[model samples]
Target: MKRASVAVIPAAGFGTRFLPATKAVPKELLPILHRPAIEFIFDDIVGAQIPESVLITSENKSALAMHFSEAPNLESHLQSNGSEHLLEQHQNLLSNTTIKYAIQDRQLGLGHAVLQAEQLVGDRPFAVLLPDDILLGGSSFLTKMLAVSAQLKGSVLALKRVPPDMISRYGVVSASQIAANQYRIHGIVEKPSIHDAPSDLAVIGRYILPPTIFHILRSTPSGALGEIQLTDGIAKLIESEPVFGLIVEGDHYDVGTPQGMLACALTLGLEHAEMREHLLEIFRKWSQK
Candidate 1:
């Protein structure tokens, strides 16, 4: 098989969880350590070696489009200031990638949001990444998942072993071990109660899905929340085809909420070898007060 040719990112949600700050800014544009959250996602997508990406966004989210677009003035300004490194960084962001945009008219659920990119995706295996979930590690999460998909030739979902008590917060999957760090998914239960959860394995945001999911997403009716849940569509896909879960070798931070965002920044800051001492000193000063 010719490797998944495209990646579809769903960025249309209102991000009501962040409230006032998000009122004027799309949550995807929120910055983490001076870089927009979506920039991290784009970097990961590029690391996966996929040549094309489709960003599914809403009308109000034009800021995201502009951010990724070429900035000749900014490039020239950086160059004039002798900041050759910075200019190269800006150039790298636009190079070696073909980006396409698809508009989602309504803020439906994730499944509906992904369906909007069907035409761009065409009939082939593709990846879907949720910007809300930021994953960090020595290796790219998508890259590892793609390797698993290449070997299995089936859908692959990044899995994390969450606390049993927190299973209700995510879509939990029941799976049987297929090999080291791999599982054949038997079924997926979305946000089930702790007592009802099938397994502790929860599906994070990254996915390698076959094109059949588009039809499943379209046929899947809106749920009680009047939104098409991606979990529901995945459940339908599982009925007819085999789906696998690859336990991602990394740490995942849910950046959709305020607390989670702070945690991610702190974690990244603490891990920075150059800034660790300064960050620790600041923490110590705050503790003394």
Candidate 2:
């Protein structure tokens, strides 16, 4: 079983959902609590023991790369100021991992963004995690997916059962139970209407894809959005290969929207020991008002 050595995170989206705020700042750099949202994805990648992370970003988001790169001036300032705490936090700057950048100059689609990493991930299995979908939990769904991919030698996806009304918001899959919490994905439909949806198992951001996906993505036709949907390529891959899905356990939150970002910040803030009591008092006063 080959280990997934590289993780590809597509961060090139215009983040139109977060306009003005994102006008000068990339959404991936948006802070959830104290750290940037994309850092959580990096934490997951580091925890899974994956060595390389390929961030697919654009010219406008060069800060994404700089955020992970070494900053000599900042380091010196921290050292001279005796800000050991702050300095220690950056000790694992970029987690001391090899961070690569692939430029996605256009908003073609998720498939096109991921294709940018083909050369870097040649002939090796890779993991793709969307930066917008933040998972908060103790265990790593990615670690399990990697293990499954290794055992089955097939691609695996992270799935969560969304309500029927919300099924259309995601790429839903028709799957048959293969084992406890595991399923054999039979089909994938991208943002299908409820009436035509195959099942309620919505595909989330995490995926352990075999290198073969790049080839399929190249020939896939753009969908209604005029963007190359990743699901389109996955659907095609399943035609000649096996694709599995695991119902992941996590507090899933989509922070692509302003409302969602607020919810995530509030949720995470309330869970922090230092802020829990303070936030409780704030919420209590708000309720009285």
Candidate 3:
């Protein structure tokens, strides 16, 4: 299967982890430095040659939809101030990319949120990127997944080896290494105990999935907390076809909590060439104090 030119981002989660902050603002709109986390995902999509994106969001997430929409007033203000560069930068951010929004309405599982985009995705394969999982990169990570999926003609999941103690925090996978940094996924268990974990290779937020999985998810029963688990759907897909895991090379952060959000911002700030020295000085002073 050739890699599809569309990506789906499931951003409808309640984001209960962030509490009051998320109560009024959608978690996807939170800034990771100068850009919102969703923008990072969009950057990856555009780099991967994906021209269209469907954002699956719930109510009160219109702000997220507006972020990609034209801000004529802001553009005018910047242009009138003789800030052509700023105006162009803002316009080019989403240039040549089409963003569509779908309402999940109900708070369901990640699988359910993705299912909402079936019409938008049609019958083609598509990429799924969770905004909460920010991969610090300008490009290449998603491009790699697109390559693997195109070669395998099946699903490719981004995998990372987590500590055994932390395996329970993610969906652990049992797989046989068929190639360097690549595996034939045998099974996947969600949030398993350390003792019952299949393997340390945990699934991250990046995925290139076939349209067939949507049918499986449609009939999939709700699991824990009465939410449909995308892991469960993938596990079922594994039984019928080969699913591979790619050992992604990049820094991954779960920005669902304040601590994680701060970590992402600090890491991005430190990596900025122009801001590196200033961030280092502030870090040095804070550490000494």
Tens digit of per-residue lDDT, candidate 3, span 35-67: 777777777887787889999998777788777
Write the candidate numbers in order of decreasing TM-score: 2, 1, 3
Model 3, runs deviating above 4 Å:
87-90
Better of 2 and 3 by TM-score: 2
For each candidate, what TM-score against the reference? 0.96, 0.96, 0.95
Between prediction 1 and prediction 3, the one with superior TM-score is: 1
Worst lDDT 10-window in candidate 1: 85-94
Cα deviation at 252, candidate 2, in Å, is: 0.7
Give candidate 2 regions above 4 Å deviation: none
Q: Could you give the C-alpha RMSD of every candidate to the true structure, in order shown?
A: 1.4, 1.4, 1.5
Can you list the residue pairs that collide in candidate 2? none
